[model samples]
Target: MNVTTILLIFLLGAVLTYVSGNKLASKIALGFSIMAALASFYLLQLYLANQNISFNGVWLQSPKVFLSLQADGISLAMVLLTTCLMPVIVLSSFGNIYNNAKSFYSLVLFMAFAMTGTFLATDGLVYYVFWELALIPIYFIALIWGNGSIESRKKAILKFFIYTLAGSLFMLIAFAYLYTKTGSFLWNDLVKLNLTSTEQTWIFLAFFLAYAIKIPIIPFHTWQAKVYQKAPTVGTMLLSGIMLKMGLYSVIRWQLPLAPLAAKTYMPYVLALSIAGVIYGSIVALKQKDLKKLLAYSSLAHVGLIAAGCYTLTQDGLSGAIAQMIAHGFVIVGLFFAAEVIYRRYDSYKIKDLGGIRSQTPKFSSLFLLLVLASVALPGTYNFVGEFTVLFSLYQINIWYAVFGGTTIILGAYYMLKMFQNVMLGETNTKAFADVNWTETFVFVVIIAFLLLYGLYPKPITDLVTPSVKEILTIINR
Candidate 1:
């Protein structure tokens, strides 16, 4: 797990930020993100050099449990994603947040640490702890600094916290049952214990309930829209861009392989729900006047497709699902940041309140246009590659599913272009508006570059993930 390196870096960042006071907190957080990035790079190099790494002794060994920390290829990929996004997220929020900067930045770093631990933790108990820990900092960040009416923000955060926690309780029970059967909390130990089909069914449902609420397929998504709408832009970015992936990742890492027969038995209903989310989310997004709310619903729709892809149980589907997860993370963050730029300038998120932005803020308009194209899966954008691969894979499962799911692109384009036309190119609404400043320009440029670069050269990511995806498929097929 490289526990020493991971924990040392995380603790050092938290302590330094806490003691440095608020004025320098942002700097400290940025510095820590850079350090984490470098460390992640070094860890990747080490993994490449060694191909295997582990640190295991005994943190706790009791009659019913043994705690261990472990990392594998999938965990490492998630760690890299977390570390890579931290600096960017910090930088994106820099000029945007002013009051109590120290607490804000410190919470950001702590959240990163918790998320990293959640991915790397090998023990079920440790995973659950980190899972809940990751939610705390974001809760306060949103509650304290988020936009919208104070009452609404409070309601949104409370709903998000309660809904996820309720689902998590069921997951905890599932873990307790597994511990009872195996007498260990370690993942490998749990994986080795054989349970009957009925037992696996109940346990898998418990875990699925927790993750589905997080990934938030159709009926479980009532809390997500308000949370994203009320939370601060950066908080929304974190939740939509990264935190949601935790649920999808857990589905792959724990549920399917852990209870293969149950997964297969329930796959049809899961797929149905995912498809419904796709159609329903897109339809609802079309009616949203608020840009953030629109994007939130759009995200739900995209994730639904990814969830369906995951359950397809094909090599292409699994690989595409993983690729789409990363692609969506990047695209959605960039999109939300774009929304923040407009809100900052016009002081409005209402689509009707904006018009003819390209006449004044050419740079901002162009960037927004490019992102919109990417969001709708333009051929040269990263999303197109993911969408194509996902649909192609879904085709193997059922052609009707692919055909229906393909409507998302058409629906996405309808709303995305409509939003673009309304916001960027109509009657000039304001007398004058400024283009993107240096910070805004830099953020958009980086996001666009990755979108284009990965769109053209997806092979690298595909190669890095293929072996792991293949291994997962083997487990499911077993």
Candidate 2:
């Protein structure tokens, strides 16, 4: 089968899961997610076998936007990340009971469907449609299913929705302008346009506004922590684990090659802004008392580094960004799940309220500690490999950039270790914090296994994305 089949699986899954009724919705969703993951692996095999897995066809005549879904190494890697995490994300929700299980699970699958299409779409208009479509599911998921003060949650999610939608308009306008110059909206055609430096700058900034808000680079990141704090744990997982990558991925996939001159011209300034975010997010994370908010800020910091790597426009930088993207996706999910586990038993996320979890639940504390160390980029963990490569790429560009970005390692260690100690160590908590159940253990094991496996032997991932990254870099430097 072709790659479009993967999207069909998720779309069909969303419908079937909803019709299965509440009692069976979660099970059906999990089964479908697993099936999708298997299908993705099959796609991976086809990719390795040098099969043609992409789809391209005419969809509209008025604007000449083709229904193009191209599967390359870079896109396949991202697709794999989305599909594999779908099952883990679905399974992670089994512990909590929601009011409308069917709708919640269905939205989860629908979001996956949209996001998968976003990664695969090769036509500019088609990509934007999937991009916008992805936002809709999360809006309802967080707004309807989220927790906290009703007024505050609504405020946060709405601000996020409006703010991002506004940014996307600029990208739409930029695409419209490009369409005027070139009659086609296909990626190959768009990248071949020889725009002036001035034109490239505006186009770059247009795309930057859209990506930065989604990536939420400093000055634009106000919406993230609040939304993360308010959303349900599973919603939080989906946002931090997968949605954020969309912006970062777009930077590599669309922004750079499409505006190579601007990328080069503004390299220093953007790199500075990204590295600044690294420090900013880390320090903010350091002061956070809420577990989810802390993890949210930590995500902001980590993605800043990933964005920095992308802007470096080097093979190492692009490849490292992808590696880190995958690593952060899994690690962050595990960390958030650990927070949910603690909240499940202790009914709290405040660092002040949690202590001595290790004394009560050894298995959970061990897994939580591993996740914490992974966040801090301790060697032998997947995070360390990704972070180091990103830093190395920064170093090649400017030592100062590397120096500033490297603070994530130190600051990350300080904040994460401190959080772990406050939340998991110290006096035995009086609350009866049960160890993780089989499902929880399964999720943790799956994530940790991937992290450890890839951390030590990263050649598979690096190799998979290298050729695509090289090709993209060629277009950017052409």
The top-ranked prediction according to TM-score is 2
Off by over 4 Å in 1: 1-4, 63-67
Worst lDDT 10-window in candidate 2: 427-436
Per-residue lDDT of candidate 2, residues 180-202 (tens digit): 99998899999999999999999
lDDT of 2 at 145: 89
Across 80-167, the per-residue lDDT of candidate 1 in tens digits comes to 7777777777788776756877777778788888888877777888889889998899899899999888898999999989999999
- Kindly report which residue pairs in candidate 2 clash with one another: none
- lDDT agreement of model 1 with the native: 0.84
Model 2: per-residue Cα lDDT at residue 257: 93
Candidate 1 residue-wise lDDT at 99: 82
- Regions of candidate 2 where Cα sits further than 4 Å from its true position: none
Which candidate achieves the best lDDT against the true structure? Answer: 2
